[model samples]
Target chain A: TQLLEQSPQFLSIQEGENLTVYCNSSSVFSSLQWYRQEPGEGPVLLVTVVTGGEVKKLKRLTFQFGDARKDSSLHITAAQTGDTGLYLCAGPNNAGNMLTFGGGTRLMVKP
Target chain B: NAGVTQTPKFRVLKTGQSMTLLCAQDMNHEYMYWYRQDPGMGLRLIHYSVGEGTTAKGEVPDGYNVSRLKKQNFLLGLESAAPSQTSVYFCATGSIRRQPQHFGDGTRLSIL
Candidate 1:
């Protein structure tokens, strides 16, 4: 079983629409990170939330960490074609050394 | 600076063949990890090294071996490869301070 589960494996939306991607898990983590991967490229870090119930915003992107630290979410306002990519959420294992990633959400924003 | 890089971006191999994938990181990190990402599945860890001369098994370690002879390089080896091992392999490096891991583009391996 996957430790972290991401919903809406694929998403297609119009350029001015809004969307949210979720990453759920039963295990609690000390911290969680979000990444975006473009085609033929490696994943790049977007944001990291370390506190329970923490919410962070990067321009039009909003990220939330569950109060229990068992889940996280990414929200995009007025999505643009440039925001299209694979979004993945990851949290460290019990030892806080290695990370376990979600399946990922593939977002496609058409212009 | 190349934060992380993998060689042989694409490769095709026949069953029973052996090969090695090299990962180099210029971040001078102490932790390095190997992962394989299959369709419809999240990246699964194969092996990891905490420091030079030390290696440990991750979520999936069978049919794979790794070595960290130097602080900046980690190598993943497969002996007697099988078709089941075909997938996109990724290498990552990170620090212990909760810093996000930086990944390589990935190596597309196909075994027939």
Candidate 2:
């Protein structure tokens, strides 16, 4: 079974629309991270939430870490075509060494 | 700075063939990891090294091996390639266990 689960494996929306992606797990994490990967490219770090119930915002992107540290969410406002890519969520293992990744959510914003 | 790089962006191999994927990092990181990305399967760790001369298995370690002879280089080897091993592989390097990892574009491999 996958330790982390991501919802809406695929999402396509209009340029001005808004969307949110979720990552859930039964296990608690020391920290959770979000990444975005473009076609033919590797994933780039977007944000990292270390505290439970912490919320961070990067320009138009907002990220939230569950109070229990067992889940997280990424919400994008005024989505643009440039926001198109695969969004991935990961959390460091209980040992705080290796990371376990979610399945991933692909987002496409058509202009 | 070429945070991390993988050689031969793409490759095709036949079953039973052996090959090695090289990952180099300029970040001078102590930890390096190898992961395979497959459609609908996400990224599964194949192997990882905490430092030079040390290696550990990840989520998926069967049919694959790794080595970290130097601080800046990590290599993944496939003794006998199989169709099941076909997928896009990624290499990552990090300064600390909790720090964000930098990734290489990826190596697209296909075993016929």
Q: What DockQ class does candidate 1 belong to?
A: medium
Candidate 2 per-residue lDDT, tens place, B3-33, comes to 7989879999999999999999988999899
Clashing pairs in 1: none
Query: Which structure among the candidates has the greatest lDDT?
Result: 2
Instruction: Give the root-mean-square deviation of each candidate in angstroms.
Output: 1.6, 1.3
lDDT of 2 by residue, A1-111 (tens): 339999999999999999999999999888899999999998898999999999999999999999999999999999999999999999888776578899999999998
What lDDT score belongs to each candidate, Candidate 1 first?
0.90, 0.91
**Candidate 2 deviant stretches above 4 angstroms:** B98-100
lDDT per residue (tens digit) for residues B12-46 in model 1: 99999999999999999998989998876867889
Angstrom error at residue B112, model 2: 0.7
* Residue B63 shift from truth in candidate 2, angstroms: 0.7
Could you say which candidate leads in DockQ? 2
